[model samples]
Target: MMELRWLEAFVAVAEELHFGRAAERLHMAQSPLSQVIRKLEKNVGSPLFKRSTRTVELTAPGQALLPYAYRILRSLNNAMDAARSAEGVPTGRFTLGFSGMHNHDTLPRITRALRENFPGVDLNLVGGIRTFDGMRQVRNEDLDASFLGIIGDVGTPLRAREISRHHLGVVVPTDHPLAHRDAIPIHQLRGESFVMGPVDGNSSMTVAALQICHAAGFQPEIAQAVSDPFLIVSMVAAGVGITILPSEVLPILPEAATWIELEGDPVPFSHGVVWSDDNESEPLQAFLTILDSIFPEPTLQ
Candidate 1:
């Protein structure tokens, strides 16, 4: 029987594509990590990696086995967590990180559920961080999970499931020319200035707004880049510049500003939770169980 440690070695190598880095991540010497890969490949009767002095790539078999490997490991973790839960209430610590739209209906409800269900587990809610920071922290295990406003795939080693989707809208000063219109095409704002969140990967909103403008065939003239969504709206209200945002921020819009839908094909904007598959703490599992109850089904964007 193949040991679980071998699967761990396989996944680490497959993700990093560098035996040295993978071994460092696994805290094992490069020689033993290489031996484990060889052993796993032999048991499967195929080479898993095409290794070179500088480049390492997964073979076809390795590619095919990757998803199953993730599932097997996740299943084992879930099974273990279940067994532990049967003994008594779970007691441990879980830290959750979030960026943008912290007041979204889904997030508050999830936190409330966690407090109610796992009172024995200490919960730490960290907010105001950016999406990229949250992703990095979750992968590094500094946080058990992160709620993010992501523009694209969450990528490998980490997984994300959508919490909710939002429609794109334009926030303009009540006195602006476009304010009277119920909706605005992105192209109309080509020469207009925009207020957006910081571009330092902290704000997925900035990326989403830029992408919308790019699709409309122009680069936005950014007037300001601030971190707070509320502040972004306030800037627009004070005539700093108009801005694009997800509809979820509508409630916070002051009377000085109005939100108009983007008059075009819907752009995909999603809020989701991100976590590493390698974190198997019972507290995390319990928290995830609450999340699963809320999301119920996987959302594919």
Candidate 2:
């Protein structure tokens, strides 16, 4: 039978491409590491490495087996992590990702709640450009979970639970002509130049804004495209141009800017918790439950 220990030795040597270094990394003697590789090759009935006085290299067989070895190691590590997390003690370090719509105030409350409720758990937050990358990171096991924007068509390979929604509004400079208005009609800004978010980063919002403009009979002349909300609002405050943003962002608005309710069709922004369906953890589920309770939909007055 081929031993797992031998396979691990072979993998280490294959990765390092130097037996002495691989032995040091595995904390084993070079002689034993070489013996394990030879035994592994014997069991497989093929040469896994080609070695000369000057160099050591993987043979064709080694190349083919490297990926399988990596997969096995990853699976083993994940399984161990899962088993430890399943103990229900909630004492493992986990990374949580977020992008777009997570208010600065709300995140602190969530962090405090996590600290209070799961005292044993170590939580790390990773913020990204937007939901797409956050979702990808969670699904790929780079993150334990993430808060993401629910917009356009939701992609596959990720499971999401709606946590909250906020109304969209227009942000303009305080001294701008539109600031005096309680709400602005979408059609009224048709001929004006606008500062906008990145089309790829905020694709759903960008598309919706374009469609609204198109329906109103003119295309918005985009003066600048930015990825960060703070920068976008800063540019607006400088009289660059107005932008549409979620109402929750109004509280964070710079002193030079004012927010107005959007008139006509209501464009709602949705936020959700996302995680990998295949490797759901007890800690992740607990975190999600906390989020659901904290941000329950408010009853319309």
Put down candidate 1 lDDT per residue, 1-301, tens digits, no spaces. Answer: 7889999999999999999999999999999999999999999999999988889999999999887887787667656665767777876667898754545567688888988988867899887867888888887666889988867778878998877777778999999999999877889999999999877756787888888889889999988988877788899999999998887787678899998888877776787789998877788878889998977653433
TM per model?
0.69, 0.73
lDDT (10s digit) by residue, model 2, range 12-129: 8887888889999999999988889889999989999999987889999989887677557656655665687676666566678765445475677787888898876679888753
Q: Which candidate tops lDDT?
A: 1
C-alpha lDDT of all candidate models, in order: 0.84, 0.75
Off by over 4 Å in 2: 1-78, 82-87, 152-155, 201-204, 297-301
Cα lDDT of candidate 2 equals 0.75
Q: What is the lDDT of candidate 1?
A: 0.84
Model 2 clash count equals: 0
